[model samples]
Target: MIPSGHPDAPKLSPLKQLHWSKVPAANTRKTVWDVSEESIKLDFNKQILDRLFCSKTNMSRTGTHSTLRNQDKITIVDMRRSNNIGVLLSKYKLTGPWVVDIINSMSDEHLNKELVTALIKCAPTSDEEQLLQSYTGSKNILSPVDQFLVEMLKVPKIRERLNCIQYKQSFDSLFEEIINGSRLVERCCQWLLKAANLKQLLHLILNIGNYMNSGTARGNATGYRLNCLLTLSNTKSLDQSITLLNYVAKIVSDRYPHLLITSDPLLEAASRIHWKELSNHLVSLQQGMMTVQKEVERQQSTVGMDTFTTKMNQFIKSRLDHLRDAANIIRGVEQLYDTVMKYYVEDYSSPEEFFSLLHNFMTMFKQAHLDNLRDMENDKAIRPKIVHKAERIMCQRSLSTTSLPRVSLNLAPQQEENQDTVRSSAAAAAAAVGSNSGSSIQTKSKGLIKNFKNIFLRKR
Candidate 1:
């Protein structure tokens, strides 16, 4: 039976080792350990020696990240002093490629993952200019694994794929596949979303259309970009929104599909962009559209109103039916003169000639609709005058004279003649006036009293 530490680790003894691939993928990793479940442990003490060149990758800025922390049994890292690590790396003679074989061939999930992580921590954070110069102690050339990891950081394709990936996967077998598989992706979805700008992604799409239709190179643009733009036009998500417009220059070429590009630039802006600014920009664009619509409507209304007025004016000028009654009288006399002069005033042998001309004129005028024309003219001419006259009559008022004289001279003279009669005359006059005044007051007061008395008496 093949032992666990046997040289032939690729194929294990079925009865003792449980050939991993034979088991379901879910339970494949459960190994028969020589010790208890807690016996498997991590040795961070050897970390300074390992400098795991295999696992280091570019720290991604596009994705969310936490500082690599020391967890419990899963993975353990103590906050070690950099001086300690530096002193450790100094003594080591790392004779061969540190990460080459582990990354290229290793299948041990735990050791591989931990070693890569340790390598990432070893990467120069503060003085990267000096660290990259060292080249990880490789005099001839860096190993494929180390060089690939370093280069993958800058690749737009890799960075974007990494960003799209799940944040926490306990094992990283798929991580390498994800990185390598990015190059195999057919559609430029990752590029479209990952591009720095719409125009850049658009250019890539245009090239794709030009070169990569159904994996066959047909040299022309596609409906996909146009459709993409239309789709993007409605999206608020920046990554989704700009997929169309990125290559407009190429899509349209010399001949523009639409003379008006109705896209809102704010929609195609970066995802991390401020939403408030985007909202403001969109509002301003909407206001612009509203202003344009209003101007168009106003102009149309003005033109329609003008055209209606012109038509009415033309209709009015084509007829002579609106002469007033007073004006018609003068016009009729002039007509009579013209009719009479047409025959009699010239060389009429009898009055019959004059009648003939008058008859003909009347017949012609009737055929020309002069009767209806006259009534219309008369109504038009008289309407304002009638209204004016009615208004004047309504505004006028007539007041009746009071029976009492405005001046009391006549009353005073009558009183003075009786003045010699003195106090008795004055007293008698005053008594008569007082009696009349008192009677009027008594009548008013009695009437008011009667109304009140009647109301209360009825209620009671």
Candidate 2:
């Protein structure tokens, strides 16, 4: 590598020389000839090596471009003014006067997304703003675009105005999405109340619990909390091979087959609704409107901002009406949710909690149903082997009846032991069922009235 500041070496860096060496000799010769002809025609500098080695960073650091760099105080403003401003405006087909017109008129039709984004990025910083404001030089010395930028920065809250325009452009579509979400909440409430199959399934779960808790203190309960549904999967048989959820699914399939078929399309969507996030969106919408209103008032007091203020005034009026409608819809949804909670006699903090509980129960129930079917299939596959073994043993006993009398006598004790084992297993299963049922019932009965009242009053 060549030393960076070596005076005796050629002006070109070793890196550049290596790059040029790789180029075909014919092309290099033609390029040099072209440069010489151009120099003769335009009276350009003859020091081609010096020109090739020169770069903006090298010139700025050495004060070679002092006129552009302003002695050593190089900044983003200087870079933009020297290099980027003209290309940016030309590429976007914009002129200084046209940009001023667009900003003053607040015409979103002319200000597309890309242009707005670029303007936002180009907003002057605090230091740049101070520098531009302090400059008392003749405006004639600055380019038209640079002069426009200086004047534009003089307006108060220019950045806020640009951001407000972007928000306004997207406000309608965003508001519509929020409205649709509220409507979805309303539909979920309606489905919970009016779905016949869902009601029947809950009733079935209640009956199953009552049957399991027979002869215990919780045997005769008429109602249970919705939260108890989540515990069904936790209540397993003594061997841990079957859960209460499995039993419920098996019974539903054998008896009320229609309950297995979910016709309501809203369950999946409702299961995913996050009430807190939805609430936050509503809050943001309100805050955004207030910001827009404040901007409009500011514009109304300023001269030359009449067109923007007028346009925003109309926008605010229409949006306020839409927001009022949305408010009514939200209120109706809350009322519906309150009614559903009352009808079910359940206490939940939010709609999301209630829907999520139900969603989880349904998912577990489906999985248990699938497991039961698989077990039945396996049992079917094993039945033939069991039958063949039993038949062979019976034939042996019949053929050697006289000799096997002693064998039969010995087998009687084993048969009794097997029966005892079966009985113990049954007792253990009943104990599990009773324990689970009692715990769920106890949990449901505690703090019922207080929680229900708190949740209901909060909703109101």
Q: Global lDDT of each model?
A: 0.35, 0.67
lDDT of 1 by residue, 1-460 (tens): 6543344433211111222335455564555533454666643433232223213223358843233322111101112534443333444422124433332232245323344444344433434323444444432243322333344333222221121111122213322332222222212223323334444434554665566355455555443323333332232335552323333333443344342122222222222233233234434433433443444345445544333234333433432232222234333433443453442224432323333332342233233343344656899999999988864442221011112122322335546543333323323333333445546644543443344334434433
In order of appearance, the predictions have TM-scores of 0.13, 0.62
**Alpha-carbon lDDT of model 1:** 0.35
| Best by the lDDT measure | 2
Candidate 2 has its poorest 10 consecutive residues by lDDT at 401-410
For model 2, the local distance difference test gives: 0.67
